[model samples]
Target: MSYEECVIVDIDGTLAEFDAEAVRQWVLGEEKQWLPFFEHMAQALPGVAVARLVGILSAQQQKIVICSGRPASYQHYTQTWLEQHSIPFDALYLRPDDEDHLADEVVKKRLLQRIREDGYQPWLVIDDRQAVVDFWRAEGLTCLQCAPGDF
Candidate 1:
């Protein structure tokens, strides 16, 4: 597909309900409770409106690419969740396992490079994080913020 036809979307807080409090607690805590955090997120409910919008875009022939700060190590769970929810996506990109310590925007920027290399020219992005939204805009792509992402 041409670059103008591809759209990027985020998983957490965009397509799925994100528990900010749980994430904040985990981030503030010293221990790395990654497994539990991932498990909790795996059961997150889908964002109906956003999912419908994505479906509409897909029906219109826009290539949907699922991109997120979620770790690649838990890709199985992410993929299963997406499949179970019937969210259409042409590709899924997640933060590398070793790069989990990096900020969301940094990780996504690296993923963007990979996406371009894979022959997708993403024209728009749907995300719910302030930093990430800013990053996408800085990179000259239109980004729609689906929710308050100031956390």
Candidate 2:
């Protein structure tokens, strides 16, 4: 397919349910706390109903690219969850494990740039964060801010 047919979507709060409370607890820990929370999230968080959107895009012969702020270390669990939930995706992008401390918007912006540089002419993005949506809009990209209820 061509780059014009590709769209990007976020994971947490968009396509999957995230345990913010658990994440807060994990962040409060002394050290290596994120590890346990990562494990917990991998198994606990549920997938939202993205099949409808996937089907719609599929019918249009468009591509769905998953772009998440999740660390690369969790890529395995994330992929497994997507598979189990039957969420269709043409590509998956995650944050580098070493840069987990960076802001989500910054990381996502960089990722988006990389995607464009890699030849994906994404015209639309579905994200849960208003900041991300705003960023995309500022760059003249179409974006949808997905509310929790919209999932």
Candidate 3:
């Protein structure tokens, strides 16, 4: 088929779930002391559903983006998780800015603008947050509602 059918997925509450509690536990205290807990928390939010759906798209050479508010520090964690588990996605777009420990709407918006300006035309965006969805819709872009494990 044509690229018109390509799929682009988001991370938080979509392709993957965020363990804010666990993350907070790590950050609010000695992170090194909670390394295993952090890993466990991230690992426990598995993406089986998304992975299976992605498998279908992968066979067709479709592009996928695991966009997330979480910083890219977890990029390697996600990358390894998906790759080791046979999950398929063309690229991963973790937040690039680190002005703070958390990502805000402005950061997401800026990234979205940059992605579009760079000539990326995602056929459809699968995201849970409506803010991003609304932004995309305002630009006349297509999108899909997604949840963790709906892969």
Q: Give the TM-score of each candidate.
A: 0.92, 0.82, 0.68
Rank candidates by TM-score, best first.
1, 2, 3
- Cand. 2 TM to true fold: 0.82
lDDT of 2 by residue, 11-97 (tens): 877787765655766743333466676677667544445556765886788888889878888788889988887788888899888
- In model 1, the number of clashes is 0
Q: Please write out the lDDT profile of model 3 over residues 1-151, one tens digit for every residue.
A: 2233346677656666654454555543422333454466456554567667777887877766666555566677767766766667766666764533433455566666655555556777776666667666676668676642211
Clash number for each model: 0, 0, 2
Ten consecutive residues with minimal summed lDDT in candidate 1?
Answer: 25-34
Regarding lDDT, does 1 or 3 come out ahead? 1
Report lDDT (CA) for all predictions: 0.89, 0.75, 0.60
Residue pairs in candidate 3 whose N, alpha carbon or C atoms collide under 3 angstroms: 49-151, 50-151
Please give the RMSD to the true structure for each candidate, in Å.
1.9, 3.5, 5.2
What's the lDDT of the predicted structure labeled candidate 2? 0.75
Candidate 1's residue-wise lDDT over 1-151, tens digit each? 5454599999989999986877876642544567777778878999999999999999999999999887888899899999999999999999898886788899999999999988999998999999999999999999999988887
